[model samples]
Target: MEFLKLPKRTTGDRSYGLTSIADFGTPVGRLISILDDYSHIIDIAKMGIGSAYITPNIQQKIDLYKEYQIKPYCGGTLFEKCYQQNKITEYLAYLKKLGIEWIEVSNGTLDIPLEERLTIIERAKEDFHVIAEVGSKDCDLDMSISEWQEEIQIFLEAGCEYVITEGRDSGTSGIYEKSGQIKSELIDELIKGIDPKKIIFEAPTAKHQMFFINQIGPNVNLGNVKLDDVLTLEAQRNGLRSETFYLEEQNANYINQAPAH
Candidate 1:
C-alpha cells in the first residue's frame, strides 16, 4: 500500500529519524509489526536500562532492529551498573559480542565526575557510537543552565555523537519538573550556547514531544519515546496531528480565512 508522502526532515546521518525505547519484555513480533508501519521514522532502539539482561531472545530483537536499519543499544543505566560492578571492560566486550555498535554513556544516577565521564566518552568513542546523556536523575541535583551547557560542550568535545538531555522514561526528571513541565528557560539558555541539532531531548510524554517539535522545528531529535507513540509523534512532527496541524506552512492560508458563524 502506498503511504502519503510527508515533508522530509533532516535526521543527520542516522538511518531512521526518531529514537524509541524498547524496554524489557517488549514482544519481538509486536516490535516488528510496529516497525513495519513506522520504521522509516525510527532510528535508534534502546534496550532500556538493564532490560537487555533479562530480555528473552535479545539477539533476535537486535537483529530485527538492524534488519530494519535501526541502531540498537543498551541503556546507560546498564552501563552505570557495569561501571559500579567494575565490569566496564567486560561490558564493552559483551556489547561487542552482541554485535551492538551504538551505546549511551551517562551518569544520571551515579555521580561520576565530569572528567571521568569525559574519559569514558573518549574511550567509548574508540569502539562505539557514544550518545552521552547530560543531567542528573535526582531532581534535587539540578545544575545551573550554564553548567548544563558547559557539560554538553565537554561531552561533544570528548567525541560523543550526540548529547541527550535526561528525561527519564517517566518524563519527570532531569530536564523536566515533577509535573512533566519542561524547564524552557534552561533549554533556551542551552540552545543559545550550543547547537540544538547535536542534542537529543528525552521527551517521553505527548506534551513534551509536541513542545520540543514546536520549539525546535520538526527535525528535532527526541529520545525515550514509548513504543505506542512512535507514529503519533511522527504525526506531530509532520503537522498531521491537531496539536501541530497549524505548523504546516500550507495551512497558513486556511488559518487566516474567516470562519462561518
Candidate 2:
C-alpha cells in the first residue's frame, strides 16, 4: 500500500525526463548510497575518461550503477586507447570480467580503418551494448555530412545502439566549429540519411545543449556531459527556467488567449 501512494503530479512540478551523471570517483560509494534517492530519474552514469584505469574499485562502482538501474559504460577515449594499443580483445575481456554490460567503441584519437571499426562494433555487439562514435578529436580533421551519414549507417547496420557525434570535451572540436557553434545545416543533411534516435551529440556546453534541444527536441541524445551539469542539462530538456521553456509557456499562453467564439 505504501508503494501505491500516488501524489498529485503536475507539469509545473516536473522538468527533465532523463538525466545522466558522470562518475569521477568523487566519493562514489557515498554517491551511490544516495542514488536510490534519485534513481527513478537518473538514467546513466558514464565512468568518465580514463578514471576506470586509475582504480580497480570501478568494477564495484559499475555494479552499483546497474543496481540503481543506471547504465555505466567506459568512455570512448578509453576504447580509443585500447584500439591504439591493439588490445581491443583484451579490453572486451576485461569489461566482461568487470561485469559491465555496456561499452563505447570509438576512434576519436587513432585512425581505425572503417572496416576494422565495423568489425570492432560487431565484436562488441556479441556481448555488450555497443555505442559507436564518429568525429575526430583533432580540430583540423573535418568530416563531411555524406561521410557522417555513411558511418552512421555502417554502425547502425552493425547493431550499434547509438552513434555519438564527437564534440570532444570542450565542444570546440570535430563537428562543432571553433566558436562552439553547431553546423545545423550539416547536421540537418546528416540526419536526412540516418535516424535521429540513433544519433547522440557530444554537447557539453549549455549553448550546445540549448540549440540541440530547440532544433531536435528535448529527447536528443547528448554525451560527454560533466558530472555537475546533469541537473542543468535536464532543466533545459524539460523547459524548466530556461528561455526555451519560457517560449513554450508564452506560446501556450497566446493560444489560450486567442479569442474564441
Candidate 3:
C-alpha cells in the first residue's frame, strides 16, 4: 500500500483537512456501522439542520461519535430556529445535556449582524468550541471578496476556532451560483491573504470536493460531505481517485484536472 500512497495524508485527531459529514438521522446501529469504517477520515458528525431538532436519538448518536473520537454537534439551523424563537439559553442547555462538545454559530438564515453574532459567540464559548459561519443562504445576498475577508477576520479574532463560508449542503447557494457552480473568482480572491486551514468550506458534491483538494491542496478543510462519499473524498484527496489520480505530492495544484463542467 505504501507503494501507491501519494504524499502522506494526515491521521489521528487533526487540526486541518477536516471532513464534516452530515448525519441526516442514521439509527445508532447504522451510524456505528458507518463510523467504524470512516471515523479516521471524518472529523465531525453534524446532526444536519432538520434532524437536530426533533430526533430523539441525538444522545445515543452523540455518545457513539464520542466513542469513535469524532466531534459531534447539532447543525446551526437548530440554533437559528432557537434564536428565532428567543430560546437560545434553552437551546444551549439542551446541547449541554446531550454531551455535545462543539457548536456552529451562524446567521446564514437569520440576519444577525456581525457585532451581535460576536457577542453571542463569546457567550457560547463558555460552554462549547465554536465554528462561526459567514455568508447568506439566499443567492441574492452577494458579498465582495474584501467584505468576505473583513467578516471572516472579525470572526477569527473573536475567538472562533474556525470560520466556515456558507456553501449550503446543496452546494447551490452562498459560495456557489444559483446553478450550483462554484464561484471560482470569488473563492480565488477570498482565499488570498487568508489561511485556508482556519476556514472550513462546505463542499457537498464531487466537483466541489475535487476543486478544493486541487486548489488548496489535500489538507483543505471541507464540510457538508455525505456519509457514503467519505472514502471517495479521502481517495481524491490522496490522489486515489481517477479524476485526481495523477496527484503525487502535497498541495496538489493540478487545477487542470478539474472535472469538466
Candidate 4:
C-alpha cells in the first residue's frame, strides 16, 4: 500500500483541483452505487442540459448527492433555457426548492449580454455557488482568445466560484478542436491570463484528462466528466493509472528519475 508516492491532490471537501461529473439522468440506484464507492473524489454533480427539469426523482438525486458531500446543480443549459423564457426568477426559486446549492450561469447556446450575465451571477451568489461557463456550444461562434479571456476575467470579477471552459459533453467544441483534440496553444494562453485554480477545464475524454494531468499536473480542476469515469479520473489524478503513472516524476521535473545510462 505504501509502495510509491503520488502527486498531492486536494481532498476531503476541497475547492480547487475539483472533479465535477455530469449526470444525464442516471437511475437513482446506479447513482447510489457509484457514490458509495467514489463520492469522496467527486466535488460536483451536474444534471446535464435541460434534463434536470424533466427528470423524475430529481429531488431524490439532489439529496443523494448532498448526502455524499457532492454539490449538486442543474446545468447551465437549463439556466439558458430559463433565461430564454425570461423566467430566471422562477428558476432560482425552483433550484432552491430542490435543495441545489450550486448553479451554472452560462450562455453557450444563447447570447446573453455581458452586463446581464454578470448581474445574474452577482444575484445568484446569495443563494448558490455560481459557476459561470464560457465558450459557445456552437463551434462556429466567432470568439477571439482575448474575448474568451476578457469574458472569463469579467466572470471572476463578477464573483463566480469557478469559470468553466466549455468542451461540451461530446468532447468536441469550446476549448477542444473538432477532432476532439486539446487546443494546447489556446489553453496555455487562457491559463496565462486566468488562474488555473479558479478555472475548470471541461475534459470529457480519457485523452483530455491525460493531457490536463500531464500539462497542468494533478491539481487541475476538471469538469464534464462522465459518472463512469470518476474513479478512472481519480486514478489518473493519483498517478495510479498508466496514462499518468509518471505524473509525480514529471511534476518533480524528473528530479528523482535515474540519469540516462
Candidate 5:
C-alpha cells in the first residue's frame, strides 16, 4: 500500500500547476511552438509592459496564446495608461476585439478612486478574467496594512478574481523592500485577515518565490512571474524541488502516517 501511494502533494495543482512565465520576444509563431510543446503546464502568459508597442503584429501573438488555452493580457502599466486617460471603454473594447481572455486592473501608476476601481472590476468581470493589483508602483505611496485589508475586501466583493500584491515585475519595492524581500509582519497580518487563495503575491525573484513558498505554502497565488520560470516554479510548489523548503512539521506528519503495522 505504501508503494502504491504517492507522496502527499500540494493542492491547486492539476498535475503541478505552472501559471506564469517570462517574455516571449520572438515571432508569434515561435511562442505558439513553445506553447504547443508545453501547454500541459503553462497556464498564463503576460506580454509585459509596453512591449506590445514595438510591433503591430503583436495581436498575432495574443491570438496564438488564446489558441493554446493560455490567458494572455496586456501589462498593468498599459492598462493604467488607458484607464488614466479615460479610455477604459476603448481599452475594454479593444481587448475584446483582440480576443484577450485576461486583464490586469491596477492603480499602480496613477490614482484611481476606489469607487471607480470597483466599477472597473465589475465591468471587467462581465467579459474578461480580472486580476486586480492592490498596491502602488511608488514605494512612497504605501498604505497601512489595515487599509490593504479593507481594500482587498472591497475588491473581492466587487468581483476581482485574483488580487495581486504589486511586485512590479522586479519583486523589489512595493510590499517588498529594495532588497526584494517581503515584510513578514505585513504578510502575516494580511493573511490573518484575507483568504490566501484570493490574493497573489507578485514574486518575480527566486528568493521571493522561495520565501513565499515557505511562508504560505505552494497553494499560494503568485503573479508577475517570468515566462521561462513556469516549470521551475511548479516543481518548487510540488515539493519535487527542495529549495523552497516545506515546513518540517508537514514532512513529519507525512512520514508518520501509519504504514500497515
Candidate 6:
C-alpha cells in the first residue's frame, strides 16, 4: 500500500530526532509491521537493558532493525552489567557479531569515574558509534547544572555521536522531578550552555515529549520513547496532532503570506 506524501520534518541525521525503545515484551512480527509503516520516522531501536538476552531470535530482530535502516543497540544498562562483570570486551565482540555498530556508554547506575568513562568512550569509538549518557538514573542523586554541562562537553569531546540526557524509561528520574515534571531551570541552563542538537533529552512520557518539543522546537532530539509512541510523537513533531496543530497553521500562513509593502 502507498502512503501519502507529507512535508518532510527535520530528522536528527538531517537535523535532530527520536530514539524509540524495543523491549523484550514486544513481539518481533508486530515490530516489523510497525516498521513497515513508520520506519521512515523512527531513527533508533534500543533493545532496552538486557532485553536482548531474553528476546527470542535476537539476531533476527537486530537484522530486521538494520534492514529498515534503524540504528539498533543494547541499552547502556547491559553495558554496565558487562563492565561490572569485567566482560566489556566480550560485550563489544557480541555486538559486532550481531552486526550492530551503534552502542551506548552510560554510568547512571554505577559511579564510573569521569576519566574512566571518557576512556571508555574513546575506546568504544574505535569499533562503534558511541552514544554516551549523562545524569544518574537514581532520582535521589543530585547534580549541578554546571556538572551536567561539563560532563556533556567531555562526552562530546571524547567522540560520542550523541549525548543522552538521562531520563530513565519511567521518565521520573534524570531531568525530571519525582513527579515527572521537568526541572526546567536546570534544562534551561543546559540548553544555554550546550548545543541542543548534540544532546538527546530522554522524554519517555507524552507530557515530557510535548514539553521538550514546545521548549526546544520540533527538531529536538528525544530518546527512550516507547515503540507505540513513535507515530504519535511524529504527529506532534509535524503538528498533525491537536497539541501542536497551531505550528502547522503558523507555517501555512507564513508560506502563503503576501510580500510586505
Report the CA-based lDDT of candidate 3 relative to the real structure. 0.84
| lDDT of each residue in 143-167, candidate 6, tens digit only | 8988999999988888888899998
TM-score of each: 0.90, 0.83, 0.93, 0.94, 0.84, 0.89
Q: What would the per-residue lDDT of candidate 1 be over residues 177-228, giving only the tens digit for each residue?
A: 9878899999878877787768989998889998877776676778998888
* Better model by lDDT: candidate 1 vs candidate 3: 3
Clashes of each: 0, 0, 0, 0, 5, 1
lDDT of 1 at 172: 84
Better of 1 and 2 by lDDT: 1
Query: What do the candidate models score in CA lDDT, each in turn?
Result: 0.80, 0.71, 0.84, 0.87, 0.71, 0.80
Best by TM-score: 4
Which portions of model 1 miss their true places by more than 4 Å? 1-7, 11-17, 250-261
Identify the superior model by TM-score, candidate 5 or candidate 6.
Answer: 6
User: Per-residue lDDT of 110-158 in model 5, one digit per residue for the tens?
Assistant: 8888888888888889999888888888876778889888888888778
lDDT of 4 at 118: 88
Deviation in Å, model 6, residue 130 alpha carbon:
0.5
Cα miss at 159, model 6 (Å)? 0.7
Q: Give the Cα error of residue 166 in candidate 3, in Å.
A: 0.8
Expressed as tens digits, the lDDT of each residue in 146-213 for candidate 4 is 98899999899888989999999998889877878777888888877677888999999888998888
Kindly report which residue pairs in candidate 5 clash with one another: 21-226, 21-227, 22-226, 22-227, 22-228
Q: Give the Å shift of residue 114 in candidate 6.
A: 1.1
TM-score attained by model 3? 0.93
Q: What would the TM-score be for candidate 1 when compared with the true structure?
A: 0.90
lDDT of 5 at 172: 68
